[model samples]
Target: MDAERGGGEAPAAPRDGEGRFRRRAFLVGGGLGVLGLGGAALVAGPGGVRSAYTRVVCGSTPEPPPGGTAGRRQGTLEGRRVIVAMPRAARDTVPVVVMLPEPPGDARAPYDLYAVDRYLAASPGGFAIASVDGWPSADIVGALLPHLEAGGLDVRRIGLLGWAAGGAEALRLAAQLGSGVVRAVAATSPDVTAARAPLRELVDIPVWLGCGERDDRAPQTETMLKGLKALGATTEGGISSGCQDTAYRRRVLPEQLAFFARHL
Candidate 1:
């Protein structure tokens, strides 16, 4: 099943002062810990520090527009629902980032939880966001790429982003698809043990892995980062203030989107 709707105009880019503030806050909050750079991990206790960090990084979370906002499409592929958000300023054929939401999160999570549509709108050289419900699989991608390409999205350059279990799935799928197909991947609070792909498969693909400093899975994320670096993979990430929840994911989403924009 497939349906398309017109989305509202893309939001304006952040002002110079706001952009500078966001960059400064990100650095001060220790959010720049790129994995391969040997940067120190950032840790924050609950309450004030975490709350302030969240506010600075995420700003205000906007409510998703009713039905479909501008530059958005909805469809079902391989029996799973999908939501594709494009930038109003997109070219005839734009690259796409495929989002695999955590378990219990559906296609709407990217828009509802992280306000990805707004982010997409602000991206300079805009790309499309394809958020999928349930686990990501080759079968789904096999069907999804064609569907998106038919709609004028570029299928050659692809990126992946995921949260929690979905994060692990993203890594595994990136390896499965290989670097030729996947340009980059970003994951938040991923369950590394669940990603069984051999490390060598990821060497050519840029991987960004992040998790909340207080999350129990932070150690696993750190370990995964180290392993990826050792394998010569282009990887970046670090621990932030919150735990494995929506707020933390939202805090790191901008960086993830930036990573996608840079490499995809």
Candidate 2:
């Protein structure tokens, strides 16, 4: 995977990725409050769903993620960055979908504005996030183990999210981790071509696919849902109402959050 934002009209790629730090500073230093602590804690609840997930998927944090000087990039050892607007009294450690362009202004500005907490509430698996910017898969997944051990996250439960090409990565992670991924919510996925076998090597992980009905990108996203299903990957689809830029006018986050609630 090139593991970097590929297309878009974003003017600032934020080589520093410190733009969020500036915004983070303006937040007055709030703690990772327990809004979705309820969700993360539900990992071991009744029903075979929770127990089965932990026994197979959850693991120890692999290594220490990178950390460095202020006013510079604090490399996301475990994930990427994207700007998220939380409610006034928002809590930390919520279950995040971990989309690309994580919490800072990145190349994908149009896509970055999707995961605002009010717009997309957390699911049962805690609302904490772990994003990736076209970085190495091993680096992203590998660093997460240490982040958990250091008390950065409960870690046992989390979900993944992405847009456009990022959606391809989201599904690949689910397939790579198998039962480890609680659920995947992706829109305008690019990996699902009608003739290719991109996700055929995966297992039965429930995937919620979305697309803008009028967007030309639907071909790949649609093909993915169909192909993954044919491959017995337990995949599904969700179509946003408006076409192209206005696709979000259909309120994708809410439905995705709901889908995660049921599966994660």
Candidate 3:
């Protein structure tokens, strides 16, 4: 079933040094090493198109939202219960944003790191954002997306947004989905070191990364920049002076949305 929600006021264009970042551009092109995992094979195709064997897939069955609300739904992905948030919008077909959860292990981790309500408040009907409960693995993410696609969200204009550990997932999904499936990617306080192989396959997409100046993860942004550039992605980002981790996301989400507005 399609989910619907009210839209929020889009923020005014950010000003220089006022929650907006300067653009730093770079480019790189290279081939990625092939590796097999989870019974998946690797087959190189023409025009950089890799076969499904190179893709990691998870099994899932779609179920209706609980309590009659389209925003919250539960489904079984490879036997594990996965929760997804679908924004309620007036339009029948809305743009989609797949949000990956924070990396497992944090004591204070919320049920959904993407914060459905926060997004609803920011750009309610603008996009149908799905935040799923699962690790940032290729199989799991691959499984959840089809269900949303089936629910009427537009896959052609898809976007991926994540923070911290989830940021790694966003990058991997962008790479795995290849050049056509994903239009843009945004990461906040991401752990760039996670999942490097798949990340090397990314090509011809726009990526926005935000980190905190005081946060220790700031340096990793450089590492990510180099990696995305080498993979032939157009990249831009900035470091918020006093933000860190969760706080960094809070300040960056607006910028992230703005970036998506431009590219998606």
Taking all chains together, each candidate's TM-score versus the true structure is 0.71, 0.53, 0.59
Tens-digit lDDT track of model 3 for 48-152: 223332221211112212333336555665655555445555356777777665755221142333344444435424665565544543354456667667767
Write the number of the candidate with greater TM-score, choosing between 2 and 3: 3
Give the per-residue Cα lDDT of candidate 3 at 206.
88
Best model per TM-score: 1
Q: CA RMSD for every model?
A: 18.5, 21.9, 24.2
Model 3 clashing residue pairs (backbone): 4-88, 4-89, 5-88, 5-89, 7-125
Candidate 1: where is the Cα deviation over 4 Å? 1-70, 136-138, 194-197
- Cα lDDT of all candidates, in order? 0.74, 0.47, 0.58
Backbone clash pairs for candidate 1 read 7-69, 7-70, 7-71, 8-70
Q: Which ten residues in a row have the lowest lDDT in candidate 1?
A: 35-44
Off by over 4 Å in 2: 1-96, 101-112, 121-125, 132-138, 148-151, 181-187
Candidates ranked by TM-score: 1, 3, 2
Off by over 4 Å in 3: 1-89, 105-114, 194-200, 226-232
**Cα deviation in Å at residue 170, candidate 2?**
1.1
